[model samples]
Target: MTGALTVRVLSGLTELSLTPPLARAIWGEDDGPEDPVLLQVLQRVGGLVAGALDPQGQVWAYLVGLPTARADTQHSHRLGVHPDVRRQGLGEQLKRFQQTWCLERDVTRVTWTFDPLLLANAHLNIHRLGAVAVAYLPNYYGAMAGINAGVPSDRFEVVWPLGGAHTHAPWPMGPAVDPLRDDLPADLPGALALCVPRDYYRLLREDPALALEWRQRSAPLFSRLFQAGHTLVDVDLSRGQYLFRRTAC
Candidate 1:
């Protein structure tokens, strides 16, 4: 069982200092923390930098957001939960806190990006947060380190609508895309199931070649689906598939 958590809107150097160490703990050495100067600036300019503290007073999770060109929206840049406290709902709690924070400030939408192959992230971002993947970005960041090392940085840009009722369309029964196959479907379907590895990190560790192959194969497929007016609305975590439905352009 998890202990009580206090989610607070963090400010000042002291509270914010807790984030850097926590980030390194969660993301490894190469993926370090957000710059302190940037964090302070975000707080000063209507952005959010918040943390979740466990009962022992340790900051276990942190989230950061920045104002966007559209005043009604914000881009959530980073969210990290310490490895020790993961899978205990702390991530969801921090997001819910972000939702409340955004709603109060008249921000109605939150946007972020994540790797399309990560099952846990896909489940949380699509299934748990009610976000829609509007675009497919291939090699978005060019290169990276730590867990993401040696892999192309493809991402799904998603937006989570806040301050109102939101829902993803029901999962569709449609054609499936075989991840292992080299071939691509000739045409788009009304609904599509794009399967991914159940555990991408394992594949990356054991067989980096196969992992890179998956990225190369699915990159074009995702781009084509989005081009054909399909939006990623849901994910089947158990089956490790993303559910995309074609919509009118």
Candidate 2:
């Protein structure tokens, strides 16, 4: 760890003065702390990683690379915002920085996963930026240990089509005019439904009942669509929820 505010790439091991508390501060306490010991071990193990800096030589953010295997075809580790300065658009900034970093390295794709139930994150991933929530992993984390420990940790694996603009099938475009009316519920006996990250989290917080209701209600439609041969790729975080545009039928 060198001076204040320099995005230095460390060759071996560097302590950026950032800790796990900082990570918990922003993303909630359960996601794991940004501990130096843990990070050192992780970096040593392998991954493209970086530590954020401030003017006076203090670490502000921590960026890690999921080097071994990307969440999808491309993309490395999950991005985390310091608990203190989250919502200041720092996470997005970090991601864009990572995206560019990946592209420069000849990595054409980048992917990450998130709880589709959490609405704010959903908005952050989809609406403000352009990411997709194509795959839904039920109980992805098994049992989350931190802040979100009480709830189910099912995650939506989001993919950033950094390779290029994704070629989507001609599924009817949305603002669906009337999703409730035009989009008739497909018949899916055993299927999982899409949940916007932030919104889903909010439901867990604001109305656990509603979240429960959605899990059951969406099963049929989501399953039906998939069974009918519709593919939910790069979900539309463009609006608020995990809106998947059927790329193939």
Query: For residues 152-185, what per-residue lDDT tens digits would candidate 2 score against the true structure?
Result: 5666666666655534323233343222233444
- Write one digit per residue (lDDT tens) for candidate 1, span 137-242: 9999889887788899999999899866657677666556776784546876778888888888789889999999988888888899888888888888878888
Error of 2 at 29 (Å): 4.0
**TM-score against native, each model:** 0.93, 0.68
Clashes counted in candidate 2 amount to: 33
Could you say which candidate leads in TM-score? Answer: 1
The 10-residue segment of model 2 with minimum total lDDT is 188-197
Relative to the true structure, candidate 1 reaches a TM of 0.93
For residue 155, give model 1's deviation from the true position in Å.
Answer: 0.8
Model 1 ranges off by over 4 Å: 1-3
Error of 2 at 240 (Å): 3.6
